[model samples]
Target chain A: MTNELALAALGDPTRRTIFECLSDRPSAVGELAQLLPVSRPAVSQHLKVLKDAGLVVDQKVGNRRIYRLDPNGIGDLRDYLERFWGCALTTFKMKSEQKGQE
Target chain B: MTNELALAALGDPTRRTIFECLSDRPSAVGELAQLLPVSRPAVSQHLKVLKDAGLVVDQKVGNRRIYRLDPNGIGDLRDYLERFWGCALTTFKMKSEQKGQE
Candidate 1:
């Protein structure tokens, strides 16, 4: 369900870059803004997009807002893929069994 | 790498449904068309998109084309999420260490 949110969040090139930057180290709004071509407010906007999608978490350490990847959200994607694979395996097994009986 | 392909492939609602159909069992183009809301050609086109994205594989069983989910592709997505988590954990550890030193 929310996997759609994750995909759409990452659909943008710049958001991916911001997420990549966070992967290295959780940084402040100004810090991330300096690294990317986007301004501070834009970075904040992108971060909001990521957070809402459950991809990243926001922390307030003192006056700075630190953003980092949320493992649960990323893990949710893995679970979804696994479910997909599980469906495939079940199908394969059922088909092969039908063939054996025929 | 190939995940972008997977994402774009699933971006379409119809393509996702067609994939869901295959998840149950591999079926011919005509079979999929009958089960779906679209024409045989449209289903064929969606299957082509899915195949190119590395999400599904095709096998010719006699005169029919059977489609199934590619486990390797779905596994690749799981691995990608795991890598993303690894990056996040590494960053968290580094940040905590920095705070300890201060």
Candidate 2:
């Protein structure tokens, strides 16, 4: 469920951009807004979705909230992809052997 | 660009479902339609999108086209995720040290 939500949240182009930005380094909403073409409020909304999906986490720094990519979430997403990677490779090997027999 | 296309291709819930099906094992349009709630035509459409994104490959078996996960594309996507994983970890370590200093 968490992986599905993370995937769904990243389905949006803007959200993906925001995610990539966070991966580069942690930043506040204003910084993200400056980096992207979207407005501050739009960035905030995207961050909210990301947070809800567990893809990002925010820290209270002074009066602002700094956002960064959540390592645990990224690890889960990576593991999900890795599982498919293994499955695909196994299928490929089986297909190749079957083709050899044909 | 390729990774972006792949990500956008998988943004849809139906597309993700189709991808998961392919990962389990290669199947034809009819088989996929049977397993999924969507119609045969819908399955075909989703396969087209997946193919266009380089996420799937099809083989002509007799009169049927069998669809399977493209290992190359999966490798690319895995690499992309791995890159972010490394970046996030590095950032996490840095943040911890910085916090220690404060």
Best by TM-score: 2
Worst 10 residues of 2 chain B by lDDT: B78-87
Per-model TM values vs. the true structure: 0.69, 0.86
Candidate 1 TM-score, C-alpha based: 0.69
- Model 2, span B2-88: residue lDDT tens: 777788787788998888888777899999999888899999999998888788999999999999889888778778767746877
How big is the RMSD of model 1?
5.4
Off by over 4 Å in 1: A37-42, A60-64, A89-102, B37-42, B61-63, B89-102
Clashes of each: 0, 0
TM-score for chain A, candidates 1 onward in order: 0.78, 0.86
Residue pairs clashing in model 1 are none
